[model samples]
Target: MLRALRTAALGMSAQQTSVDNTANNLANANTTGFKRATVVFQDLLYQSVQRGGEGDQRPAAMQLGSGSAIVATQRTFLQGSLMQTGNSLDLAVNGEGFLQARRPDGSVVYTRDGAFTLDADGRIVTQSGLALEPDLEVPPETQEIQISSDGVVRVRLQNEPDALEIGRIEVAQFSNPAGLRSIGANLYEQTEASGEPQIGPPAEGGAGLLQQGFLETSNVDVVQEMVDLITAQRAYEMNSKMITTSEEMLQIANSMKR
Candidate 1:
């Protein structure tokens, strides 16, 4: 009975983690470059029971198992559809890699969201106003802005029809992105497990080609999440039933006449 209770508790805990993951995805459905996370679970250690009679002499080693555990949290890197916002600062990645942004604390962060805007200083900034790594600055007198297919940023000068180049956007990648830690606000931090960030120009080394005037949407699949939710709910209920049954048996055994 005690073992069953422990198993039930572990199952409940795992389900809670799954629920949290799903809820977070729903909340970020509208967030740009926000990758949804899923919790990975693994069964606890298991002990084998006796099998064959001849071999049973080896002591079946009474079967035992610990509850489940959270093995990891997986981030989905699936590409999101692009939405055209007609803003020069709004950019999207057509393929692999992520954009490097400069956090306020001076630490570098990576993201897929390119919904950018200009700060008072005419510096290119993300929707959250974080500056890009390379830092592209436009002239305050420029009337219109344009970004080339190769990620070259420039603006139209009043006296010149030609667009004067400003700066090129830089893209980054990791050998194992699953090791990244989410720091909230659609930003990811590098870790030893994820390998060092590979800084390079867009469209290089499997990095995504930059697409200006657009933004990448979240890649979460609502249908898949719904199915997983059902499975977790059913498994949790079954574990609860097992615990309840074990408790009833214990109660009945204790009721016997002393």
Candidate 2:
């Protein structure tokens, strides 16, 4: 009975995590450059109640499981919807890799969201206003801007027909992206298990190509999330039923003792 209760509790806990993950993905469905995360679970160790032996001894009988554990929260590298914003500074990745941004604390961060804006000081930044890495700063006198597919920043010269090169956007890549831990802020932190981040220009190596005036929309599918929510809810109910059944069995055992 105790084992049954523990197993039910663990199963419900794992299902709760799955529901949470799916809910979060649904919430970020419209978020730019947002990547969907899937929860991975594994069963706990099984206990053998019946021991194996020769000479008329029964074979080992295995317990179902103690419970389940959230093994990992894997990020879906699958591409999101690419929507054109038509803004000069607004950019999106056409392929893989992330745009590097510098935080206020001088720490570097990465994002797949390419919806960028130019600050009052002519500095390129995200909507949340995090400055782009490599420091793309346009001159005060610059009239127009143009970002190449390769991520080169350029500005039109005054009274001139051509644009001048400024800087290139820096992108980062990872080896084991599935190992990344989500620390909220729609950001991921680096870990030894994920390996060191590989920094490079857009489209260089496996880095994704940059698209001017485009933004990467979240990849979450609403219908899929709905189905998952229903499944999780059902699993939670089943676990509750297991607990009830275990309690009833215990009650029956007590009646026999009486």
Candidate 3:
């Protein structure tokens, strides 16, 4: 009964974590370039009761698992659907890769978001003012800007007959993208597990091509998340029932001793 109680308690705890992960996914269903996460669990160590005996023809050892635990929360990197905004500055990636941006402290971060705009200094930057890596600068008197599929930036100066090439956008990749650390505002930093970033132009080395006037929508599927939420709720209830039954069994045993 005691073992049953402990196992049931652990089960309930693990289910709670599942519920939390599902909730987060649903919450960010509409967030741009958002990726959902899933919970991973593992059974705890087993307790041996009896060893096998060859002479006695015993089949195998008797054992019982102590419990289960949430081992990790893994982020799913499946591509999200692209949305068309038709805005000149909006950008979207069509395949694998991330855009590199520099924070205020000069630390670099990678993101899937490409909704960019020009800052006060005519520098292309994210909404939070983080400048794009490689530092693309548009002329103050530019009338139109264009980004090629290979990430080449060009602009047409006011009253100019031809467009002039400005700079190229760099895309970064990782060996294990899920290992990157999330620091909010749809930004992620490289980690040891993720390996060093591979910087290059788009449409090269598995990096995605850039799409102007478009943005990537969150990958979360509301219907699937709802189903997961229901499953987790049912599992939690079952674990609670197991704990109750274990307690009742203990109570009955104590009454018999009277």
Give TM-scores for every candidate, taking all chains together and pairing residue i with residue i: 0.93, 0.92, 0.96
- Model 2 residue runs over 4 Å out of place are 51-64
Ranking by TM-score: 3, 1, 2
- Candidate 3 Cα errors over 4 Å, as ranges: 53-55
lDDT of 2 by residue, 1-258 (tens): 988899999999999999999989999998877888888889899776555674467565445668898998888878888898898887888887877888899988778877777899989887788888989889888899999888888899788788999998878888987666666665667777878889888888988888898888888989998999999999999999999999999999999967
Model 3 C-alpha lDDT per residue in residues 79-185, reported as the tens digit of each score: 89999999888888899999989988999998998999999999999988899998988989999889998999999999899999999998999999999999988
Total clashing residue pairs per candidate?
A: 0, 0, 0
Each prediction's RMSD to truth: 2.1, 2.0, 1.2
- Stretch of 10 with least lDDT, candidate 2: 54-63
Query: What TM-score would you give candidate 2 relative to the actual structure?
Result: 0.92
How well is each residue in 1-258 modelled by candidate 1, as lDDT tens digits? 788888888988888788778888877878888887888889898866555344636533566787897888899888888988888778998888888889878999988888888899989888778998888888988989988766788899888879898888888889998889888778889999989988888887888888988899888878877887788788878888888898998898899966
Q: TM-score: which candidate is best?
A: 3
State the local distance difference test value for candidate 2: 0.84
Q: In terms of TM-score, which candidate is stronger, 1 or 2?
A: 1
